[model samples]
Structures are given as structure tokens and as C-alpha cells.
Target: MIAVVYSGSHYAHWRLADRGKTVASFRTSGINPYFNDEKQITTLLNKNINLIHHAEQIKRIYFFGPGLASNELKDIIRNAFLTFFKFAKITVAHDIDAVAIASCKNTEGIVCICGSGTNAAWYDGKK
Candidate 1:
């Protein structure tokens, strides 16, 4: 099973997949205004635990977010995943990768995600 987790400006979302097929999904509101705050971090951890509880078959998790580029945020997220689901293999993915993949279907151009944050990049097809 594979889990894809993401956080937006107002909420966080997660998708669970088994054998390339999505099996379950979850979402929750963002509570903290700042990403570094302990309370807000705890809220994210709780949400992850809740999501994992519902998808016990998940064996690996692919985390996606903008703030994940920061080492501090990465540590926090890594710790949270370990605390909740120790057995699952966790991998952090840049938000840009998601944008690139989504845009690839259209053949070329700029793909922008203007939600809680913004990201843009050009793909030459060499990827």
C-alpha cells in the first residue's frame, strides 16, 4: 500500500493506494497559522495518525508539500510518521514533482498551483 500526504493553506489531504489503486482518502483543516508552531505540528501529527488508523494496510507513504523543503519541517514530519506508523516506509516528495507530473499529461507549458501556496516550473520532457 502507498500513502500520499499533502498539506495546503487551509487543510491537509491524504490518499491511500494499494497496487496502484487508491483505496482510501482523508482530509482535515489546518489549525496553526505558522508551520513551525508546536500546536499546529501536533495537529498535523494527529491527522496523520487518524488517517493511518483507517488504512492499516498502508506500507509506504509519499509525503508531498511545499514546506517539506525545510529541514526543520522535514524532521517534524518524519518524527510524526515514525511515532504513528513505525512500520511504514516514508518518503518526502517535493510539491514541484506533483505539479510536473500533473502537467505532463498536457504535453508542455507552465503548471501552477495557486492554493495555500504557489509553485511553478518548466518541463523540457527530459525528465
Candidate 2:
């Protein structure tokens, strides 16, 4: 099982999949470690316990958010997921990395992201 998430300033969307097919999806407040604290992010996730049920089945999680600008922030988000999806392997990264990976995979190429803001990069396929 796998989980994928994309977060912006306003919302964070997540989807759980099994064998490449989507099984469940949920949304919580944007778990941006920049503006919102761990308590707030926890509140958002707790608000939807049903979502956590699906999260439990996930073995891997790829979380991307615009606010993950530092390792400290990444740790915050990672810890939040750990609170619920206790056994899942979680990977948190900036939204820009999400954009680049989504478009180019592990190949060298140029990628551009135009979400709430704009960014462009030459990705060597790594985030």
C-alpha cells in the first residue's frame, strides 16, 4: 500500500492506494509546519478519524507541502503522521520537489511549478 499527499497553504490532500488502485482519500487542514503548529496539525488530522483508518493500511507515504522549508519543519510533519500511521515509512519534502518529481521522475529534465506561487528548476531527478 502507498499514500501520496500534496499540500498547499489552504489544504492538504491525501490518497491511499493498493496495487496502483486508489482505495481511499482524505483531506485535512494544510499541515504546513511554517504557519501552523504541531497541535494545530494534529487537530486537523484528529478531526477526521476515518481518514486515519485508511492511513493505517499504507506502508509508504510521500508527503509534499510548500511550507516544508527546513529539516525541523519536515520532522514536525513526519511526527504528525507517525502519531496515526504508526508503521508507515514517511517521506516529507517541499512542494517544489513534488512538482519536479511528478513531472520528470528520476531523469534529468527541467520542471516548473506554478501553484500558489511559481518555481522552475533543472531536476537531476532527486528531491
Candidate 3:
């Protein structure tokens, strides 16, 4: 099975699973004051750790989020995931790109996601 995880200013964490022809998904509220702060970041990490713990069948994990501009934060998140899910293969994808791909032919006109953060992309019929 494969697991896809993501977090952003608006969401603390989210997970999706692909199992043969079935798919499962869920989302959690973002820790308060979502940002680069230590407390909030730790909370987010804890949330991810919990999710990873329950997904024992997940062989791979794909993370989608904005690339951290701060190397310190990047290292922190990387180490946390490694410590929590040592066996899972992890990959990161740009948040905008994920949104664009997911929105393909699903909605008419512009597809936008907005909250504490925002993402917008045009979804034409052609792939």
C-alpha cells in the first residue's frame, strides 16, 4: 500500500492510502498558530508520527507541501520522519503541483484552495 501525507498552514496533517482498487483518506486540523514556531511545528510532527504509526501497511509515503526555506526547519522535519517511519520510502512533491494534478477535469473553470494558505491553478480539459 502507498500513503500520501501533507500539511500546510491550514491543515495540521492529512493522509491518503491506495489499496488496489480502493482509496482511504482523512485530514486533521492544523495546530494553532501554524508557522515556523517550534511549538506548532512540534505539534505537526507529532500528528504525522501518530498517523505513520497506524499505517503499518504503507510501503511508501509521499509528502506534499511548500519547500521549507529554512534549512533548520527542513532538517527537523526530515529527522522526525526518519525517526518515526524508518522503513517507509519517503518522497516530497510541490503542493501546487499536487493540487493541479488532483484537480484535472474534476472542476470547471479555476480550481482554488484557500485558508491560512492558498493554491490556484487552471484545469483545462487536455491532460
Q: Which candidate comes out best when scored by TM-score?
A: 2
C-alpha lDDT of residue 103 in model 1: 67
lDDT of 1 at 127: 33
As for lDDT, the candidate ahead, 1 or 2, is: 2
lDDT of 2 by residue, 48-115 (tens): 86565775677898999977768998989898888877779989988888888878889888887777
Q: Which pairs of residues collide in candidate 3?
A: 12-30
**What is every candidate's alpha-carbon RMSD to the true fold?**
3.5, 1.7, 5.0
Tell me the spans in candidate 3 whose CA falls farther than 4 Å from its real position.
16-18, 21-24, 29-55, 67-75, 105-113, 119-127
Error of 2 at 33 (Å): 0.8
| TM-scores for every candidate against the unseen true structure | 0.72, 0.88, 0.57
Better of 1 and 2 by TM-score: 2
Q: Report the lDDT tens digits of candidate 1 across residue range 1-127.
A: 7778766647668787777787777786642223545455555656565564654566788766666666776666666666666677877656666776666854666667787677777865433
Expressed as tens digits, the lDDT of each residue in 9-113 for candidate 3 is 556455555555335566765423224454545455566544645556566877666645456655545555555555667665546555666776445456666
TM-score of 3: 0.57
Instruction: Report backbone clashes per prediction.
Output: 0, 0, 1
Candidate 1 lDDT (Cα, whole model)? 0.65
